[model samples]
Target: MTRKTTNSLEEVHESVAIVQNTSIWKKILAFFGPAYMVSVGYMDPGNWATDIAGGSQFGYKLIWVLLMSNIMALLLQSLSARLGIVRQRDLAQASRDTYSRPVNMVLYLLAEIAIAACDLAEVLGMAIGLQLLFDIPLLWGVSITMLDTFLLLFLLNKGIRKMEAFIIALIAIIGLSFLIEMFLAKPDVTEIARGLIPSIPDSTALYIAIGIIGATVMPHNLYLHSSLVQTRKFDRSKKGIKQAIRYNFLDSFLALNMAFFVNAAILILAAAAFYKNGMHEVAEIQDAHRLLEPLLGTHWASILFAVALIAAGQSSTITGTLAGQIVMEGYLNLRIQPWVRRIITRLIAIVPALVAIIYFGEAATGKLLLLSQVILSLQLGFAIIPLIHFVSDKTKMQGFAIGKWTKIASWLIALIIVTLNAKLVFDEIETWVTTSENPIYIWLFVVPIAIFAAFLLLYIIIKPFVEKNRTIPNLVPHINEIVVSESNEPIVYSKIAIALDFSKTDQKSIASALQLGGKTAHYTIIHVVETVGAMVHGNETHDYETTSDHYYLEEYQKALEARGYQVSSILDFGSPKKSIAKVVNENDFDILVLGAHGHNWFKDLLLGTTVDAVRHKITIPLLVVKDH
Candidate 1:
């Protein structure tokens, strides 16, 4: 039997209801929460390293990079939301629908790696924040961060609205903390305004600028936003879809700008406090915390910074967990409990982080955080390119398809992301080759991986256009394509077989068979003796259990014969499924009837299900009657 398609986050998909005939403002308010959850990715701890590095070294010159990146994020996030609202499929599911299984597996693995990379940054940031505020040891703080798995479970159990409220509260704390810090730093408004003009001072500045773009326009957020927008239950009508698109675009604009504010505040505070003091080397989160008190001459400066760091880590981690669930469910159609998935994703990130902190010392976290953002940048194209192609398909989207100019602009954004990521990888690899004492590993390891990644990217980009002319077969036939038989003649069964165990459900199976075949058809009563002796010796064994089964079969046969139905009984030995299938196929039976106990999965796992097994082995139509 063909199964129905499920939603991405089936637990929360269409969980939020939009009331019809409501005020305009009330309708807009219903779509408010999804994009805010997505925006947390933008202001995650991964952004901190790039923003701090850019602000301190260039002194507000790289602000234009942040602006441009924010604009790009707005556009791409909107497109992502549009895809989910119209197609009702997340990015991973959509990819699985179009791409081959091997290609989908590769994409799934890449997405998993990106989430782990993002989580690494959050783990480090939370650890650093704890160390700064409570004087907790960094290693101990890292261990303590795992306890939030329970906190996420609590919020999720309360429902999506409560979860959104919890996240918004955390966002407000981060925003308010940064707002006060912005006032404390008191940056020069004119220089900040002048910094909006685009400029790159050096190669180092170019590297930091790409990091800013990577940090701001995160790849995971595309997979995230596409699924998140589906949480809201809206109208499926044309007017309803258009309204959902408009309101969600507004949500992305506002929420991402709020994220922009938090990021800009971090950079501006870094510039006004560090660069203005001639401290051009402040790149680490802990280093920034240490210097804030003395440079700003207020203890609150450092205190607020640490508080905001913890909140940022906490908020981003929650959304990261949700994104992991969506990707796993969409690509593989596999799901576990939310808390179980949360622990697994966290542990994958924690191992590398604990190793860096314990073996290389706490200072290693600064470089590790920046490396995480670069990893996210590398995986960006695999997500964005497919999304643009899916949304731009005129055949699938019809009237909702993106227009010609929007398609061009979407591709332009994808090109910029791919180009910047390529440049970043090339520059980093060149530096590694030049600086390494032995460059053979780079040729053997790095070069092959890069070539493979490039080929995969090229395949996804070019496959859609190539397959536009070719017909892709549908697994199930559509209603219009199926031929209807006008004949309404009744189905008549001449020879009917009934398989039964000696339980209360046995009568129901016999009754159903009698209803179908009536008195005119011949009835064959089949039973399998599943005793230990019968299993070992088959027809030769003469155990008490087998004798009892034979006696019960005779009683059933005599009762059916007394009702004027032509009936015969047969008792077989060995496995129930294999023996029953053999009896039905060897005889001239038109249909086989059996009883289902309606057991749960746990019961089925422990004691095997005979009905399920028997159905697959038999050739004729099998009818199942459930015991209430």
Candidate 2:
């Protein structure tokens, strides 16, 4: 796992790697960091408690559940990596692009809620780890997690590879600790093998099974894996992409199986050390830690368990914070400094967790962990539905859409997950209503709300395919200085700039700029000759001159000058976004105007260079005249 590291990802989202003339093994090595980062979520402390519970209560019966969940994780994560590489948009960004503002807002909020729920589990885990290892108070331990993550993020700033190495080392600590646990707990091999045979003991077993699946297939990992894989600057060539996908799959498959092993080992240890000894009530993680020393006849076993718990919690916290940022930036179209966002997310997660720990005391943390996972389970559909929708769509992914079998398999997985989540929610509500003399409550509040929730879920699942991809936001530049003269016969102003694509909207942009500048305004017409992704090997966009955009830019320049407002045109070759920005910034123009057609957010990402990029790169008052 060792490799040379250089260059920080500070202030940069995508990172550079040594991708030139490397062996396949080296390329795989370069792509290795992201999947292990994602695997952390699968083995977080929430999963720890569930695994412990399932194993101790049922004695190795839930091992098949662990194996199936890992298979599901491997399939989903590989798809996530594929979406990022080919579409060049993470799940959040793709979702934002696909949905309208209101739907995007709802999805965004749900994603934030999911992140908070996950962080709560990690916080409780960290606090519990501290209590076990150092005997710290629960509230104080929660506070310590924030500082611990702050340090982890500082290391992250040193370089992404360095952070990757640090996380891997922690994962190694976890794996090694469990290896020791397995060695100590010499369970019957035959019985352990039997545990992998699929059979639920009862309805109670189904509940534990649901918990294991929910905890294993995390909602945040979809966003995290898609975004994190972009950090390695791989070649965008045909062969290069094939290589990237291959390496990414290897990384995901290997990492998730490792997670499966770690998870299964925990269950095996629990079954051998607790269930075999008739300590079936040792379902809580803290209880397991407490009982381990006595059962295994060594204090070091408990210490190692605590150490592994801390590693799991801290590692998950880092990934959760990163997922929060991705969701926020992608959906909100706003950026918060990473450290500030991390602090805010930590603060949010700690409050409810702190209250629960205080109200329910030390023993209730395990129950709190389970509750936190339910919160996570609720948001699973929000993430999974959009992900499958985007990756499966031929329009969104172009020809890179998933294959037929993969598409069907992904949808089936999504359905199973959604069904499990619904069952969990319904089971909880039914427990309350039937236990009470409350047919009235069910007739009124429960029935209507349940119906509404079902309808909403149906829309979320269906809307991506049904909704039109065209975008028509109010894109007119709002400037305080835009005072339209009443005399309207083209007032005189000097130096106006308009970039044109020769669309009718380009004429609108020209007219809008002319009206603002008036008769005296000299015009500098700019055209950037660029092919989207033309230089990249796998890119379908081809580079050439004498195209329609060229003709439009030229004819418009001639037509505008015929109206007698002195005009000149500049044509440059490169990326339109960057080249246009350069033209606007280098020239002394009063303003820059570009025609923007209503384009879906996903289209904008696929197109790569948009008016949005131009706006950020220039200081001039830029007017984005809407074409729609």
Candidate 3:
């Protein structure tokens, strides 16, 4: 594809051209990037090893696993893209702001670990592929893979489109290699068709089947997709956003379709040659390569297989490293040195992977792959649950948020993933206890402790809702006052009400609102509905009075007072909307300026009561300045 360079003015024209250019074929092509990016997970080195093993051991029967997994991947990737295009932010960042501190922290920690593990896999895959193709030592190849950090940063510096183009090109090479290999292998047609029909041969096949599904739709990909689509810089207009979303969906579909074909090809090659030949004991990735030699000419089979592995490893690593940056910056709102973060994460993950590779050597390939995927599966709940919560909450998302149907679908998928992980954890624990021939003290103590931990986790989940409901009633009256005061105004437009949230992005919005409104109106900063109960209960702190409140007030007061306008600061206990309304009703103001930060679609829709309630109930025209 030839790259198109254009400016903001040209972007509209170009975007229109893109929309007009759409046909079934064009849409199918556009779907390639997202699906290809997503498909990397399905065809990652770990997945390749497993797919090859599964097919060689169980023949074409396990091909159904890959097919089912692709369907689930389609559903999840669509949700991630929708969330990004609609909310205009990544999933991790959205969840961080919407969820409570402890919950958010827990989720962040788990997600970070998962991303690191994913990076580890990518690095290992690359290293292994290097060993297979170029005879480079694994440790040296791992170290060499660090250069990808600079490569990715360089690509991103050029712009997002370029990065996406590079990834798409890499996916093309991988896809082409597999297609050629499939044609050369020439597997049986009837048996390949039979593989598409789902049937569980035994418990082991079922477990591997589940693993295949779990491995395909990776959790970090959610973070990557959401953050990646944000780079397109589409116009904030409704039509423009809708068009961008449509194109994104098209991109994902094409990429995944290619991924599906590549995945199927790998399975078919293994099934045709190894399964039919009664190779039931194929144990490692290297073993599958040997089997391919007898079916296809040895040189072509080895070269194509190695090239595909190298492509998968390199492409997935680039994306995984980028995802780590997005997660850290988005969720924590912390901007660490990018290289420092990369090195830290890489070092942490490489230690365990290297130890296993060195200690168990080639024999541990299957174990390493399975363990990495298991870790990913365990961490998925942290990412998935928050996505469900943020998308469903009308308070956070404005008009563009997830609807009921999307919410239900997302919830069902999340639940199934969680259930699968839970079963894995439980079964692993049961096996450990049964196999341990040690004293009863070990089993008795460990079992109860695990049960208690699980119970505590459940309590923690329910506790937030209980506290929110209990405190909401008291806050209601204060909220009601703001709702009622929506019509009133002060004589001076100087006093501006800024609704503060835990999100640091709110600070940016507040800054912009004061700047825009300060030119025409003198402003007073007011933080309404400060919940004393939360502070007293130790759930929240009175530190807002000192930290956020004091800093912003001092900064704005200095800025306004210098400009010859009187400034006053108020931090009151009540609903923000009602308190602002009451203040407007009580004071004679020329106009009311409120800051609107576009965080979530539902939240944007209701204007957090401060803007919307005032707009609806107040007599004055509420000046809402949205910080992009």
lDDT of 1: 0.83
Tens digits of lDDT, candidate 3, 1-628: 1111111111111111233344756643443354555567667776776677678778888887788777777767777877776775688766654556676676677788887667666777788778788989887777788788788768755645566688778888888888888788788888888988989897667566656765677888888787666544445577766777777877777777777787778777777777778887674666776667776766778777888888898888877776776676666665344466566555656666677677888567666775676677667766766566555555444555677887777778777776776777677677877887874865688678556545544644455355433211121112112211111233344445554432333445445445544445555566553433222323243332334444544555565566554567665554566666776777665566666655365544423334666677667656665656
- The models' CA-based lDDT, in order, is 0.83, 0.77, 0.64
- Of candidate 1, the 10-residue stretch with the lowest lDDT total is 479-488
Please report the TM-score between candidate 2 and the true structure.
0.78
- TM-score against truth, every candidate: 0.77, 0.78, 0.70
Taking the tens digit of each residue's C-alpha lDDT, what string does model 1 give over 299-363?
99999999999998888877887787778877876545556667876787777779888898987
As for TM-score, the candidate ahead, 1 or 3, is: 1
lDDT of 3 at 255: 72
The regions of model 3 sitting more than 4 angstroms off are 1-35, 439-559, 562-628
RMSD from true fold, candidate 3: 13.5
RMSD of each candidate relative to the true structure: 12.9, 8.2, 13.5
- The worst-scoring run of ten residues by lDDT in candidate 3 lies at 4-13
